[model samples]
Target: MKHLKTPESLLFYMMLIREFELKIAEMFAYGKLAGTMFHLSVGQEATSVGTIAALEEGDFISSHHRGHGHMIALGADIKLMMAEMFGKRTGYCKGKGGSMHIADIELGNLGANGIVGAGIPIATGAAYAVRYRGGKQVVLCPFGDGAVNEGVFHESLNFAALHKLPIVYVIENNQYAMSTSVTKSTSITDLYKRACAYGISGEFVDGMDVEAVLETTKKAVERARRGEGPTLIESRTYRYYGHSRSDPAPYRTKEEEEEWKQRDPIKQYQRKLIERGIITENDVKKMGEEIQKILDEAVKFADESPYPEPSEIFEDIYA
Candidate 1:
């Protein structure tokens, strides 16, 4: 097993993402947020934190609509993120990108795309840029299972394979594409196998297990750094919320949701850490309190921050 950082740090990051997302949900419900739509990756914290833990500072990432966890895991400021959600000028995009389009270019985040499967080709192009400049950076492209059905998915994968681009295509297969299940949407259940069609390696991972995700992504990252080209990783995860803020998620059953909850990544990792004597229950509680305090301050900052002026409406727009 590769030394994938201390278990304590991994657990902390997972908790941070979970708490941040949970707060976002609460804020949205109270009309504290300005956006009309929001997507939460509540049950998918492990996949985001674990995969990102294996990356270096210079590495790049492209995110999907449910991408807050991805940005938080990548060291984004919670206050700024919350400010953006509230349409404040302190946000990463000067309050223009909102929740779905936040990007910190200085941090190597290429920004999250609202369109399905749009980030795939963007990541592929970034990888090509890395290769051309002989840079050691590798790009991680994450999207939903629904994105696999998009034409850009095939085109991007084929082009990356042909040119040996330094990227990893991480498929966050959260079972449902909005209300439609993967079974109803695609004939190929094994999403990773689609990588073979483009002559690249692929692997499936239990998205709830942070350790598994970290180990698997580490190998893929190492391969890309070695100039071995892209690898596809299909992480089977679940979303605890609807596709957006207004979605009720009536398509799934109570039992199905409960079953996935039992495998809650944060709880599972907490158990493992306690079992190994790495941390006590008190430590876990303390960590939770600390994260909660951070988020509380973030919300306060966002609430107090000024919104973008009406005169600035056309400033950031690109013709």
Candidate 2:
């Protein structure tokens, strides 16, 4: 068991993810955010922040549609991220890709995909590139439990391991693939065992615990950087919000939602920080205030930024 070493920096990161997520929620309510949102990382912040922390600056990550947390955790500019959602030219994609398609290649964030499981092959290919160049960079490919059902998931894992590529396939198993729960999707409850078919190591971690996720991911990242091939990690977590903004999550029970909220990774981590003397209530409050100010400025920037001009429509496209 790798014990987590609590540090002040890590506590700050946990707080940032939480504050950013909450700000996004507020933006949605204020009608400031446009486009469809796939919210639900409310209880899964640790899995994102911790895993990203284990990666180096050159390492890459491919995100799911619900990718805001991953991008923020990887040090994406909140202003541009918010601008992209607002369809302003200041977006990472220059206003082309909205919430589902944000990408910052400079930050090693390959991109997020609207199509389910599409990024698996992309991440595998990126890993192959790193291997071909003899670089130590690893790729963290994160998707939901729903992605595992895709044919590309199995094929990509097989190819990644076969070639000894440097990649960590992290399945954010938040219990449900949209409305379908894990119980209704797969017969084998243990998502980790699925890696056996690919002939690689598979580990399960507490997705709600930042320390646990960070420690486990650090090991996997080290192994991959050493050219030990891929590792599949199933992070058992829960999403407090609905699958999308439109979803009421009627299939789930209020009791179930409440139970998961009690296990919220952000709040849990805050308490841990306080308990460890790494941070205090005032520290958390100050962090929250700073994040809100940052986000508020981002919102102002996005609102004031210009939209795409008429001639810009076919610029980035190839016919």
Candidate 3:
């Protein structure tokens, strides 16, 4: 997608993401959703909305398990997404992929990976394809802090740096890898420093700030387009919900979650836009109404769509 030129547009995309995830949560609570593996990026809206805004239309992204926000920000159709959530045949992967494996190749979303740290290699391979074919398209790999310790993370970055592959890696460091805190899992909490070992530029950004993520990712995206090597960006962000619906987040204190909510990305950005005269309270209300209508239609479409037949199960897979 082209860079979002205005603040209002950015806010609209972020609002779309915020609503989509909340709707998913609502569906899960009502037992209307298909699976229990859904991961919601509720508090990390700005990181997704901002990072995707920096990419060109030709670029590709390999998404992590928690990637609904990434896809929604990158212009996914809500109707199809909702259909997939309901496990209907009208979905992007014909309901085969569900929430964790959604992909639309035409849209440059390589697919969301369920295995930890797996998408890194997928993005690296895509970048290699671009370099091999002499294509201008770059690839963005967005994963979590948990992926940093995986062997593939090191291997992929080492190769990308060695060959100067047109790729950018952003770690959505939401402070925990499931229940395990980063402080307990890694030797250094400053994850951007890991990029130094690969001889690439690394920077940290406040993921709560949308513009900051955009600017940081934009520089790296541009650098990759210029045939410069990869970059590692640490987006310091959070998740409002537990790792999954099944988790009550006993590991997280209510006090800490409340503190992080104080810097809520969507609320903060909306306030900034209103203060800067880029939007108004009326505009926000209108945006909400419009989004509600669109989402209602999405839910209707999903509910009416049929599930795939058992006979079609062997079709998409290769022998």
Better-scoring candidate (lDDT), 1 or 2: 1
Each prediction's TM-score against the native? 0.97, 0.95, 0.98
> What does the lDDT read for residue 101 in candidate 1?
94
RMSD of 1: 1.9
- Residue 106, candidate 1: Cα error in Å is 1.6
Q: C-alpha displacement of 302 in model 1, angstroms?
A: 0.3
Which pairs of residues collide in model 1?
none
Which has the greatest TM-score? Answer: 3
- The C-alpha stretches of model 3 lying farther than 4 A from their native spots are none
lDDT of 3 by residue, 1-319 (tens): 6636678878888989899999999999889889898899999999999999999897999998899998888888999999999999999889999999988888899989999999999899999999999999989999999999999999999999999999999999999999999999999999999999999999999999999999999999999999998999999999999898888899989999999999998889899999999889999999999999999999999999999998889897896
Best by lDDT: 3
Clashes in model 3: which pairs? none
* Residue-level error in angstroms, candidate 3, position 36: 0.8
